[model samples]
Target: MNILVTGGAGYVGSKLVPKLLEKGFHVRVLDWFLFDDNIFKDLKTDKLELIKGDLRNSSIIKKCMQGIDIVIHLGCLSNDPSCDLDEELTKSINLDAGINIIKEAKKNKVTRFINASSASVYGIKDENNVTESSKLEPITLYAKYKADLEEFLHSQASEDFSPVSLRPATVCGYAPRLRLDLTVNILTYHAVTNNKIVVYGGEQKRPNIHIDDLVNIYLLLIDAPKEKIHNQVFNAGFQNYKVIEIANLIKSVLGPDKIKIQITEDNDHRSYHISSEKIKNTFNFSSQFDIKDAVLDLAKAFENDLVKNPNDSKYRNVKHILENEDFINNKILG
Candidate 1:
């Protein structure tokens, strides 16, 4: 089967495309390749095809939609900060482009549409366990678009089109296109490199999942029966903890003496504890790794000199976008 993965050079996609290739499926990755154009350079596979282009380009998206049995939609200006760059641009890049992709997938008769939605959609939930049934009160433009995309995808679902949206928690752990901006990765990188973690508004409870488990979830969706995932949304998160708790956990795992937690006050109060019961009960899918494992994996990667400078702009989505204004205007936005 031919699988078209949007944002295939991203943190999750870099890992997922390889696994798809291993499974004997032809993988076509459509991405802008902003982080690293050569992320898949080492992959010498006949089943893998890489198309470096903007998602906004209808012609490029049209090319990607062809011969695609499954559409793994992971491309977007991720996180709240990244989308906060320009309100109009962010909407165009993420929401508008996303809708176009959904329409194209429908027209192309794609069998499965596996979307990577954000748990942030359930913004600042007072409820203990924010399930899939919970109302989405998106606090950011980035999150609002995710909720909108899920709605659009479900609306497009038909007999042949089985669209499943997984509102994943803040993803943690290492990937070829490693990200240091996330909660787990941020704390772990600072602790390992600077021997200190500076947490802003450290009390917000956040849900997270390991990158490996998230990739596995995508793989499972491909083989899962249409009846099981059809027009369904699942919360793909396991570990739920306060920001300081995660910092302390990392400190404990990485040796308490090696790390010190310095908490600072900030108004970034977006927090929620998501329940993965829907995925577990419905599809028998559960995350095998937690934040502790994510911390250890990132630490090991750092120790092995895999990440020279974790603070590099390339490791961050918003930072990279901010630093490359020229590229954003000429290449990415165009």
Candidate 2:
């Protein structure tokens, strides 16, 4: 099967694209190469095709849909701060461009369309666990767009076209295109590089998944029967941890004495625990890696110098967008 992975050079996509190729699926990547153009440079596979273009361009998106059997749509201005940086650009990419991709996929006779949604769509839930059917309370522009796209995807699902939305947890662990902005990753980076980390409003709970497990869930969806997942929404989260708990985990992994944790107060209180029981009960799928495992993996990566500069703005999406005025004007605005 020929699969098209939009944003295939991104944090999760860098890990996922190679796995799809290993599974013998001919993969084509559509991305603007905003972060790192050489993310897949060492993947010596004939089944890989790279298209360096933005998803907002209808012409580029149409060209990407050619001969595509499955569409793994992961392209967007991912995360809250990044989306907040430019709401117009975020809507253009995450909502408008996403709709264009789905419409083109249906037109091109694509069998499966898997959307990479976020658990943040269930923003600031109460003490109860948020399921797929729970009321969506998107607090950020990013989460709102994902929720909108999820609704739009359900509307587009048909007998011939199967659309599945996977509301994935905040992904942790190392990827080829490494990201340091995520909670676990940022804490780990500070523990390794600075020997200290700060926890702001550390009691807020957040759902998390190992990057590998998150990638595997997408793989499973590719092989799952259409009848089972068609027009269905599933949350793909494994573990839930408070911000302080995650900081402690990093401290334990790197060495308690080697790292210092300082708790601070912050007004940003976005917290939610998602339940993946529906997907587990229906498809027999569950995450294998836990928070400790993810922490260790990142620690090993830092120790091996795999991630040379974790403090670089390029590794942090929000920082990169904020600092680079030209990127905002030329790449995002244009």
Candidate 3:
């Protein structure tokens, strides 16, 4: 089987492309390679094909679709702050481009199309557990784009073509293209290096999934029956905890001497805990890693200086990305 993976140079996509190759699928990766193609440099195999291009170009997308039976769409301007750059650009890339990919995949007679959706669609609710059936309240343009894409995908699912949307929780842990901007990774990095974790909205509940487990969830969906995943949306996460609780968990795992915690009352627009029961029931999938493991592992990576530099642009925060789209787009040196 041949598969096309969009955003194949991304944190999740970098890891996922290798996994697909291991399963004996012919993998064609369409990525902008903003950081560097070095992320997949070690992945040498006859079955693997690398196409460096942006998803916004229909011609490039069409070229990547040739002989591809499955399209795992993971490309987008991720997160709320980044999408706020220009609503027109966000909708064009995240929503409109995504819809076009589905339409193109159908036109090419692709067997399956798997879309990566965000858990942020739940918005800032005071709920203990939000499910796939939960009413979506998307405040950010990013979330609205994803929600709109979900609606469009549902309309495209039919007997002939299948589309599955996987709503993964906030991902932690490291990858080839590392990301330190995420809550768990950020807190752990500061805890060990600076000896303090200053956090806001300590009581806000959030759902999380380790990077390893998140990749496994995607692999599971790729192989599951069309009847099982077609036209379905599943929330992907292992556990939920308050923002402060996550800090404490990291401190506990890495030892108190390694970290200190400081909490603030500032409440960000993002706050919600999600339930993964629907996915567990449907795919027999459960998260095998937790915050403690992620925290400890990231701390070790920091001590060893595993990922070149912690402040590297590729691993930088969303705020940094939004302000310097040129830095990201041009891959400038720091």
Q: Which stretches of candidate 3 lie over 4 Å from their true place?
A: 317-334
lDDT by residue for model 1 (35-111), tens: 88889989998899999888888889998899999999999989888888887777877788899999999899899
lDDT of the structure predicted as candidate 2 = 0.89
- What TM-score, computed on C-alpha atoms, does each candidate reach? 0.96, 0.97, 0.94
Flag regions of model 2 displaced more than 4 Å: 323-326, 330-334
Q: Rate the local accuracy (lDDT) of all candidates.
A: 0.89, 0.89, 0.82
lDDT of 3 at 104: 88
1-334: candidate 3 lDDT, tens digit per residue: 9999988888889778898899999999887776556898888799989887767778887878888899999988777777776677677778887888888899999978899998988777777788898989888898898999989988988888888889988999877787877889888888887889988978777789998898898889888988998888999988788889999888888777857898877846466888899999987777798888888778777778777867666676365555566534533122
lDDT of 2 by residue, 1-334 (tens): 9999998999999999999999999999998877888999999988999998878888888888999999999988898999998788788889998999999999999989999999988878885689988899898999999999999988998899999999998999999899999989888888888899999989888889999998889998999888889999999888888999999988987898879999999987767788999989988886789888878998899889898676778899988877867557636422
Q: What is the lDDT of residue 208 in candidate 2?
A: 93
Q: Order of all candidates by lDDT, from best down to worst?
A: 2, 1, 3
Instruction: List ranges where model 1 is wrong by over 4 Å.
Output: 268-270, 330-334
| Model 3 weakest 10-residue run by lDDT | 325-334
Q: Cα lDDT for residue 296, model 3?
A: 72
lDDT of 3 at 136: 91
Model 1, TM vs. native: 0.96
